[model samples]
Target: MWPRMDGIRVLELGTPGELRTELTELTLSGAKTATAGLPALDYDAEREAVEHVGERLVLVDDSGMRAGEVEVTRVELVPFGEVGWEFARAEGEGYTSVGHWRESHRRYWEGQGCEVGDDTTIVCLWFRLV
Candidate 1:
């Protein structure tokens, strides 16, 4: 979720189809100006605003876990844009390579009764590091 300079929160739910429908519906109820899909996000506008604030941004992922669930994993914030692209390309090659990672992971987890929906949600909550 990328929050614009004007406090517009943009949540990117990386699912197969309209996984963000739930979030978008909630936002429309009162959030206002809420939208789904990355196309609606004006990256240029965000880039310019980020420059004024800072280059670094924090992304929070709270999709799979239930509300108020204890977070056992550590949250790591990665800088986006060129630097982020380079980092992902170098360190996280698997992330860049499109394969059956999700399916494989789902299968592995499903064996243990953990089921990830047909679409995996990659929530990106963009925020300043302060």
Candidate 2:
């Protein structure tokens, strides 16, 4: 049986539909190991909660089902425009360039009612499948 997430804080790793399933499969298959997000909340508190290296983060699917865990290896807080291409590629979102990541993330943040700006901060979480 899959280990229950229970009281552990979970983050949604997949989008809706087939893409969601695909990302989850990649995680389980050990191909995709990193993720990035722009949380619309208190930055300091949120960072304190999630940015610890060696900490375990519970990854969930669109249905909120626990797929597995990842151990945080690195974390970076950088402006939207400052996200490096190397990290963007690590996202495994099929984004061919930093520009692609910027466009996609802008749409996602805007869709969530959050305004995206060049100086807006994003938390980039680098992890390994655990």
Candidate 3:
């Protein structure tokens, strides 16, 4: 079962199109799946996929808690490939792809200045809360 909110609630706003676009870019640059460890590819087919998946993505904590959720507030295709660039650099320099992805994710979050508690897990879910 998922843990209670425990006075902690985060709202992530984004658009389904935007989320799908990000996913598409990430896949093209090697994100290759849902944050849940799915092997998702085919950027060209993402629009259809997004429509099929709807707008919400849920993130569960290690303790099986639904730590938080992110709603797709906007959808846009940008040229931000820094994560992919860093991943390629790390891999080219002999770093493990997993490590590269982990570090990249860390940096991505750090860049956003997001923080979590020691016992807390962060899950990003995208959906319309209205």
Writing each residue's lDDT as its tens digit, candidate 2 over 14-122 gives: 4577867888887778767677777564244355354578877688876776778888899888898999898888777678889998998888768766788999988
Per-residue lDDT of candidate 3, residues 53-119 (tens digit): 3444443333334534434433322222322433233222233664465455445445545432222
Prediction 3 global C-alpha lDDT: 0.34
Give Cα distance to truth, residue 118, candidate 2, Å.
0.9
| Stretches of candidate 2 exceeding 4 Å from the true structure | 1-7, 14-19, 41-48
**How well is each residue in 7-126 modelled by candidate 1, as lDDT tens digits?**
433333333235344433332343312111121132332553222122332222334321111111212222221123322222221444323434443454456344555343321222
Q: Which residue pairs come into collision in candidate 1?
A: 1-124, 1-125, 1-126
**RMSD, each candidate, Å?**
13.9, 4.1, 15.5
Model 3 weakest lDDT span, ten residues long: 36-45
Report lDDT (Cα) of residue 58, candidate 1: 24
Q: Better model by lDDT, 2 or 3?
A: 2
TM-scores for all predictions: 0.21, 0.80, 0.27
lDDT of each: 0.29, 0.74, 0.34
TM-score of 2: 0.80
